[model samples]
Structures are given as structure tokens and as C-alpha cells.
Target: MIHPILDDNAADALVALLAVREAGGVPLVGDSRWSTQYWSAVSSHAKAECVGGDKAWASFSSGSSGAPRVILRSASSWQVSFAAVTDLLALTADDVVYVPAPLASSLTLFSVAHSRSVGASILLPSRPSSSAEHLTRATVVHTTPQSLRAIVEVIEGGAPHSMRVALVGGDHLDHALRRRCAALGIRVIGYYGAAELSFVAVDDDGLGLRPFPGVQTRIVGGELWARSAYLASGYLEDGGGPFRVDGEGWGTVGDRAENDASGRLMLRGRIDGAILTSSATVIPDEVEAALRSIDGIDDAAVFGLPNERTGALVAALVQFSPGSSRPSTARLREQAAARLPLTHIPRRWFWTEDMPRTSTGKAARSQIRLCALEKKARRLD
Candidate 1:
């Protein structure tokens, strides 16, 4: 039996999850706000593919690179990590965790389970926009940077809050966001992982990402691979996907990374997202990170467009900070050149007030590229 989560009622969702666990039925958590056609396709596919008594539950991938898929995993896979993450976060029954993200998100679902495992209460808002009322009651927040930024904006507007620590994931945490959290007196703990790979590495302080507890990570051919019991079993219908598992029980989602001087994992980006232009490869995450570090730039999404001379040309969709005017192309180029290589510099540019984001709050580069091709986005160059 596949249970679909259509509402945002935290109590109902938790009760359903517990019932499914007791009944030994697979739960397919879904968002009702999704298109009916999309939900129908997913539910039908899940019903046909989701078999096996051991399959505990299913959730969608981040889909930042492409369309999301349904992933199935056992209960122990997540139950084991609950203890690890709970201990890492120093969570206790006295804590009240707030998660504003939708239930379809694995990150939010995991946080709910983790909180319940430690006997901690949860404060899940009916709508993400209605989270301000519960903010003052929450001791810990499990959120993405996008959601956390909104919380910061709310706090800046004179709303009272009692959040002490936040477990931020799903996207990169910039220094500006960190500063805002610091001003609010909230300790930000950023982590790097995937839906399929679970917890691979974690950044405790401002230091860097080390291997997550019970997980061993290694760089293999520029991709980070890990061996951990927290990994999901596999996708429901996997023909071609980034997820890979080796004979030695090591798995990787094709994320490129290297070890820094401190022996911590330094993520470059996903290998599949590398852009091929003029016989050179450009990692969009590296370029976007560079662009975001520049003053007056709020966020960025980098991609490649088809070019006649070069195989493809590097392009970028930039979101400027509030109160900052869009800079000239030459000025933008000059700033990019200081931080990026010639091939990495974007030849095409576009600007939007708000950058497109995946459901999990990741920069939707593919969607940005599609908008550029369709002439829906305002092109600057």
C-alpha cells in the first residue's frame, strides 16, 4: 500500500507515518499542490513499481539537474542516521524543532522523523508563509537557506523569535546569510548530502565538511564516493540516473569534490552539470559561487547555451541585491574575470529579481536555461 501525503497537517502526517510503519506499508509522500497530471503519473508509477515488503517509504529527488525521481529505501537506512544526526545536533526531548518546508521534501520529512525519534516536539506550519507565528516557539529550525532567509527577513521586520540553532541544507549557505543568522543569534550548521546518499559530509562550525558519522568518504576520479549504511536502496524505476553503487558497497551521486588542506571535502559541483564550451569544462557551481561572492550580487545560476563558434557558450542568470542597479556588461565581465577563468566567465547574461529554485530550494539552472531559450527571461547580453 502506498500512502500519499496531500495535506500539510503535521499531526496527521506524523500519525500516518507511524501507522504505515506499524502496518509495514510503503508511504509515498506527495504534495497536493502539484499538478494533477504530474501527481497521477507519480502515483501510478509508484503503485506499479513500489513492491517488496522491505521498501519502507519513497520520496522525490532534489531535481536540480533534471526531473525528480521516486527513491525507495528501508526503514533502518534512515533510522540509523537519525541517531547520528540527533547526537550531532545535540537534540533532546526538551527541544521544539520547526520545519517550514513542504512534506514532499525528504529533508523536511527526515527532520520530522529525527525529532520524533529523540522525543522532541515539532512545530510544522500549515503554510511556509505562516511560519512567523511558530518561530518564537521553536528552539531549533531545520530549513534551507531560502527559507531561512525569509525567516531572517521576518525577524528583521521586528518579529520575535527564539530559534537558537538551525540545520541548514539543500543549498549553499553564503557568508551574507551566515552574518544575518549571526545577528539573529542563531547558530547555523550547514551539511552536504543528497537524497540517495544520505549524510556524506557535514560542516560543524565555519571550518569545513568532514565525513559524516558512520560514513567514509573518498575522492574517486574527481567524484566523491561514500560507504555508509544511511544510503537509500535505489530508485523505483532507474534506467539512467546519476546514482551509482560499486561492488565494494560504495555509492556516489556524481558530485565532484576534492580534499582541502584541512582534509575536508571541498565540493566543486555535480559532474553531470559541467558545461562543455570551446574544449574547456566549466563547473557552474564554481562560477555561481564566485559570482555570489561579489558585492551587489544576491544569487546566480550558470549554464551553457548552444554556440556556433564554440560548442557552447557559458551563460549566467544573475540576481542583484536589493537597492543595487544592474551593472554594465563590461563591469560584470571585469568582476567575473577577477574570480573565474576565461572559459568560466559567462558570455551571456540575464537578470531576474528572484532566481528560480527547485522544490528543495536549490538554484534551478536547467529551468533558467530553458527560460533563456524560450525568450521568457530578460537577456542582458
Candidate 2:
């Protein structure tokens, strides 16, 4: 059974998932909002090449980059760690779970499965909330930092809320967002994971993230590798999208990470997102981190665009808070130079009130590049 995220209500999705599981049928979930261009890019891989057991459930994912893929996994893949995951959140039947993302997303789907295992009630995304009254009963929320930022921007009540914990992922979250969530009486738990490999690690420690109890991890040649019982079966209709399996049943999705002095995992961002400049290779996330650290900048995404002189020139799109004093492009360049390497500084800058985000609330870098090349948006310089 294939289910699109935008097709039906949360209740209907839940019922479909349960029905598939009970009937020993594979249930695949897909995002319905993909543009024609995105579909065209992956149509070559969408032929009748279905693999995996009838009992396995599949979900479409991009595996961090490039074209989308259908990932296959048996119920035990996630069920094996459900108890440990809930125990980490201290979730119980009394807790009301909330996931602001669509039901077909891996994070939201895993949250649904976990909540169902623990017998907790869930509030899926309804229309955008103008007030916090709809969230009065929510105790725990699973969302990305972008979606949470959108909620905080329009929400009205500053009164103390009932939310206790938040499972945040999908992108790199800065300390400012964490502070904002703290002010709202919610504790933020940042995690690093991929659809191919479920929950790799969580920021249970203040320094970074410690691996889960049953999870195993190692940093090999700067890429994070995992050996866990929750590993998904290989991608369908494709050789192996950005992942490799070893003889020991360990898997790696090629994400760059490192261990801090305290043995906690610290992500360095995607290995494929590095831009080859004329002078040096620059990782966009590194430049983006520096940009967001400056005051008045709420979000940032750095990319490389074609240049006549250099093979590629660094460009950036930044988001600023409404009514906040926008800094000049020269001022931003100076501040960025102090932190980032000279070659990493953005050569062209564009400003937008809102950053481009995908259905999963992740920064849409491909779209940002298109917008930058078009030169249609407001340029800070």
C-alpha cells in the first residue's frame, strides 16, 4: 500500500499503517508535494524494480541528497528501539504527543509508531495555529527547528505552556533557537539521523550527542558509521543510494561527523555538500553557521554558483527578522570573514523574509540556488 502525506487525515494514515502491519503487507509513504522537476529527476529510477518482502514497510526518502529513494524496513527495524526511545523521552500513556509535520515524513511516521507503541495520544498537523490553545494538551512534540520557528513567529500566548520535551532534527539547530524553546518551557533534544539509519544519536549530554543504549557508532575517515539492529533494508529500485553495508552488517550513509573530547558525536554536515572553490573546498553548513551567529540573521544557506573567473563562487541567502535592523552586505562579509576562511565568505548575498523550505521543513538549497541565479529576490549588497 502506497500512501501520500497530503492525501488524507492523520487518523486515516494511522489506520492505513496499522492495517498494513496487521495484514503483513508492505506500506510505503511518499511526499505528494514534489514538483514536476523533482519527479522528472527520479522517474528513471521508478520503473518496476520493486524488492523486499511483502511484510516489510517502505517509505520514500532522499537519503540526505540527490534524487528520492524508496527505503525498505521491517517492523522490527524501528520496533527494536521503541522502548529505549520512549524511555529517553520519558513518554507514557498520559503524555500527549504532537508532530507538526506531515504523517508521511520519516520522523513523524516514527513518532506515530512510537506513540502507538506506548499508547499515547498524538495531535498531527491541523491548520496553522494562530494561538496556543490547540497545543494546550500537548506534552511532547516531534518537529524540526524550521517548523518550530514558524510556529513561534505567529503564536500569541506567552503564558507558561505544558510542553516538556521536543525531539528536534532535520537540520543544524543553533543555540538561539534552543534558548527560545527553553523560554517557552520546552526542553530541546537535538538528534542526528537519516532515513536509512534510524536514530543514530541524541543530545542527552550537554556537550553534544551520546549514542543510544542499543546503538553502535564509529567515525571512519570522517564519515559516521552505525551498526544497529534497527538498520533498514537496502534501497529499492536503486543500487544503494549514498549508503554502504559492511560484512559485519554495519551501515553508513556517508554523513561527516566527529567525536568531541567527551566521546559525543558532533556532526560536521553532509559530505556531499562541500563546494570546490578555486582556492579551497568550503562546506556550506560551516559558512551558514557563521552567518546565523551574527545578530539580526535568523537563517542562512550558502551555495556555490558559476563564475566566469573562478569555476564557482560562493553565494548566500539569509533571512532576517521582521523590523530588525538589516545589516549591510559589507558588514556581514566582515563579520563572516572573522570566523570563516576568506574563500568561504559569500561573494553574493540575497535577503528574504522567509527561507525556502521543503515539505520536511529542511532548507531547500536547490531552490535557493535557482532563486539566487534568477536574481529576482532582494539582494542585500
Candidate 3:
């Protein structure tokens, strides 16, 4: 039986405690927002509950649409993730690792664990908003594209610090952002994985991720399928049962990918709800990456909409950078043509203050697609 500790005041701490519970251990969670009551509650519970082995489970929220789903993974998976990270970062015992994301996030959890695994010191700022302070002390940092951008802002504003590496994932890493980080002497490594499947591909320590240890990837039907011991058991409540593993122990997470002739894995997008354009198929991520490279654009989301002539027309919902206005549709078209094929150029551009993101901060592709469809419908009406 699972008895999760609830701390309404601290969501990350609460989730971390629950994960500790789920992995066959007990957690003494308390309200960090309040002092005396919180510590007392935690102490009482810890004294009463049985102390178990180090192996434990933790839950994290994940989804592209609908309510977030809770994913459970073992502490061992975190160890594996950390091992890969330490290998990729070339972390040393004396290194200081910084985590800006919440501890409940798999990214942050594993990053911290990875640092600990290598005997490296961890420097977590008490506040999430203190990017500059955290960046100043750490040798390596883990961040999403958005967070990395914030770090870039700090550095550009004359923050004095140098990082050995900045690992960017949780979203597509644009070449523009990569170039900026590169100029700062911070090598940006893009990793691709989900809570359901942890650390599928990590940039191969300057060589590019050539399949990490204990993981295998294959391109089946233009979709990327993976088999790894590190894959989660399955989702809670959904009872989807265990991931389908082959006799050899390979499992898939339903991501679409392409392999270069040299066998490097390039992720396309998800298999479900992929865009089928008039001239050719459009992978939203591929197009989104292209769109993000255009000057004056901060970020973009690419998806498809119904069209009488083209089955589904490609469209982009974009947020231009500050002090920048929407580009002329013609110029936008030219920019896309420079990197993408004619079929992949978005037929229409919709400007928004910001692209909507999921609870986990991933670009909500499903929501953006729905918004595009609704606007298209309004036009028809």
C-alpha cells in the first residue's frame, strides 16, 4: 500500500516525498512553507515509519494533451541516467553541479543524482528565479531551452562566470541558441527522452549520442523505437501494462526519428497526429527548428490544419523576440525556404504573446494544434 505525504505548500517536495513512498519506502513529508508544524510532522512520521533500503520510486507529471499523467520509475533508473550524464559531462568528484529546475522534475532529480554518483558537490539555489547566482558557482548546469535562454540573458548582461557544459533538453534546441552558447564557451548538449523512457539519446560528448550504454534504438516506419532497461514499468491508473519489449529487451516510446547514413539518430517528432502536408510530410519539430533559426523569432510551434486543396496545410504559431515584430509573410516564407522544403513552409503564421506550454513546460503541441483548428474554423464561419 502507498501512503503519499502531502505538502500543499511545496509541490516539488511533496512529489519527491510521494515518489520516495511509491518505490516501496516511506516518506516523512511536511509543509516547508510553515516551520514548526512542518518539522514536527516530518519527524513524527519518520520515527513511526519503517526505514527501508535505498531503492525507491518517485512520480513525475508527463503528457502532451489532457491532464498530466503520473509516471513511476525506480531509483535505479535515476542511477542509470546519472551515469550517462556523468559520462557525457566528464564530471569529476570535485565538480559542482547546479540544478535550476525543480527537484521533482526527472531532469533535475537525475542531474543531482548524477552529480552525487560522481561524488560532485551540488549547488541548488534556494530560489528558482536566481539564475545568475546559481550559474556563478557551478561547473555544469542542466536546463531546458527556455532556462538556457535565461542563462544566456544573464551572461550577456555581464555576469562573470564560465561553465564547462550546459545540457539542454525538454524541448528542441535551435541552432541559434546552440551558437550563442558555443560562443560563451559553454558546449550545449541536446538530449532526447521522456519520463516514460529516460535518457534515450544524449549528445555523444562532442561526438553526438551514438546510443548510450544499455539502450538500443531503431527506426521502424519512420518512427523511433527504443529498448532499454531504464524504461519505466508503465503508467499508473492507465494500466497500459508494461511497455512492449522484444525478446532481446527493446521497447518503444512512439517517437518518430530519422537515421543518417552514419547511423546518428535525428528525432523527427511524435508518430501520432503528425502533419501530412500537400507536397510532402511535415514533421512539426523539424519545421519548428527551421522557424526558430530565423532572425527576430524567439520561438515557434509547427502543426497542421485542414485545407481543401492540401489535405492538411502546415501552419506556425510563433512568438517573436522582444523589440521584434512579426516578419512579412513573404520574408518568413523565404526564411523557411532557406532551410526547409516547399512542402514544409507554414501556409499561415499566427502571432501569440507566448506559446502555451504543458504543466511540465513542454510545448503543448496538442493544444496549439487545437487552437489552430479553432481559428481555421472561425475563418470558415
Candidate 4:
């Protein structure tokens, strides 16, 4: 039987997971807020796969690029990483970890499991209103960059509390965000990983992403492939999602990466997500990072728009920092030109007061592209 989890309590969910694991059954941990129809579809898909299989757990992907799908993995996959993280973070029974994200998120589920493994206490918000209260008591926090920003805003200038460390994932943690958290006495530990390949690299001191313990990485044609015990079995779907396992036991989720001069793995986004514009390939991640580095720019989402002349033209939707006056498009263009190549520079510019993001706090590239094509977003030029 599949254990469909709707409970938000971390302790209760831990107990249920332990029980389900002991019973040798698959547990489907999902968010209760998912639409009934969507939940039914995901559960039905998982149940079909769980019948007569070695799968130990089932969860949904973040669906940042597309619809969420059922992913299956052995219990040992997470169990091994739980021990790694517990040791890496030096978690103890006395520690209180706050996980504000829903149970459906693999990041939160992994945090809860890791906390339980180390005999640490976990604080999960019963409602949106309880997040701040939980943060006040937490010795550690596990959340996305977007959620962390909201948290920083909530507790700004307040007397420091018990929270000291934040384990951030699901999006890039910008320098400004990290500095803000540091001002609040909370150290951020940003990591790069996927639900399919657990814990590929970690950045503890903001140097860069080094390989996580027990994981070996290699860049194949600019695509990163990892070999580790933490890899998931496969997806429950027929095609098995984008996860691919080689004959040599290496698995990859099609993430693009390169080794810097320091040998640290630098992510360049996904292989399939690259935009083909004017016969030149452009990685939106590279452009977006450049835009974010500009003065007064808070965030950026780069995408491709269909163009009869260029086949596809690079476009960008940006958000400026709060209290900063909006600069002219020409000024913004000059700033981008200095930082990016001609092909990487955005041809079309748009602005958004509130940027659209996935549940995991990732830039919703597909959503933004759709909005721009539909003329729903405010065209800046």
C-alpha cells in the first residue's frame, strides 16, 4: 500500500515514514494543498508502480520545468545521505531544526528525515502564521532562497534568536541575500542538488560547490554526471523522467556544469533548457546571473522569444531592488552590454514588480516565456 501523506507535522511524518519503512512499503509524501485532481493523478501513478517493485519511497518532482511526476527510490538512498548531512552539519539531539516548506518538497522531507536520524528536534509550521514563531526557537533552518528572503524580512532588526544555521537549496543564494542573513547572525549553507541525484555538491563557506562526501562527479560534454549511493532508483512514469543511468552506474539529471580553476563544480543550468538564438546557443542562467549582478537589479529571468529574423531572440524580465529608482532601458542595456556578450545580452526587456517563481523558489522560465509571448508582462522596451 502507498502511504499518501497529508500531514504537515514533521515528527508525525517521521513516525509514519519509520513505520512504513519497517513494514517494507512505499510512502508517498505529498502536499495536502495540491488540487484533488492533481493529487489523485500522482497517487494513482505511484500506486501502479509500487505494485510488485523494490521501490521504497515515492515523491513528486518540483515540476519547475513541467508537470510534477512520481519519482521512486530505495529507502537506503536517503538513509545514507541522512547520515552524511547529520555529520556534515554536526546535528545533535539538542538542535531544533525549522523546516518551513511543505512535506511534499523533497528538501523538507530530507531535512525531517535527517533531523530524526540524528535525534534532533524538528519544528514544522502548522500554518503560515506559525513560521516566525518556529524560527524563533530553531537552531537550524532548511528552506529555499525565496522563503529565506521572506524570513529575513520578517525578523529584520529584531533581537537575535536561537537560529544560527540555514541549509538553503532549490535556488541560487545570491551574495546580497547571504549578507542579509549573516547580519541576522544566521549562516547560510547553500547546496546544489536535485531530487533525482541527492547532494551532489555543497557550499558551506561561500567559496564554491565542492563535491559532497562519497559522491564522484564528471562533466560529459558539459553535462554533469554523478556516481553515488544517494541516487534515486528511477521515476514511476513510463519514460522515467529526465534521469538517465549509464552502464557504468553513473546517473545524471542533465544538469550542465563545468570545473572552475579551483576544481569547484560551477552549474550552467540544464542541458535541454538552453536557448538557440540566431544560430548561437545561450544559457539563460549565465545571462540571469549577470543581470542580477548589476547595480539596483534584484533578480532576472532570461528566456527566448520566437523571432522570424533570428529564429529566437533572447528576452529578459527583471526586478529592481526595493527603493531604487527604475533606470532607463538604455542605461540597463549599457550595464548588460558591459557584463554579457552580444548574443547573451537580452534583445527584449520586460519588468515585473513580482517575479513568478516555482514552488521550489526557482525562476519559472517557462511561465515567464509564456507571459511575454502573450503580452501579459509589462514590456520595458
Listed in order, each prediction's TM-score against the native is 0.95, 0.89, 0.78, 0.91
Counting clashing residue pairs in each candidate, in order, gives: 0, 0, 7, 0
Sorted by lDDT (best first), the order is: 1, 4, 2, 3
lDDT of 3 by residue, 80-113 (tens): 6566667778889978877666554666656655
Candidate 3: which stretches are off by over 4 Å?
A: 1-55, 123-130, 205-207, 239-244, 277-280, 306-311, 337-339, 359-361, 373-381
Q: Which ten residues in a row have the lowest lDDT in candidate 1?
A: 1-10
RMSD from true fold, candidate 4: 2.5
Q: All candidates' lDDT scores?
A: 0.85, 0.75, 0.67, 0.82
lDDT of 3 at 185: 87
Give me the overall lDDT of model 1. Answer: 0.85
What is the Cα-based lDDT of residue 94 in candidate 1? 95
- Of candidate 2, the 10-residue stretch with the lowest lDDT total is 1-10
Instruction: Output the TM-score of candidate 3.
Output: 0.78
Q: lDDT by residue for model 4 over 1-381, one digit each (tens)?
A: 677765556557667876886898877876766688977777676665544466677777777677777677877898988767876667889999887877777777777677877889887776433355676798988888878887888788464467888889987788888999898888888889888998999989888899988899999999999999999988777774778999998999888999999999899998777889887999988999999999998889988899988889999999988889888889998999999999898989999888887556788888888889899999885
Model 2 deviation from the true structure expressed as Cα RMSD, one decimal place: 2.8
Top model number, lDDT? 1
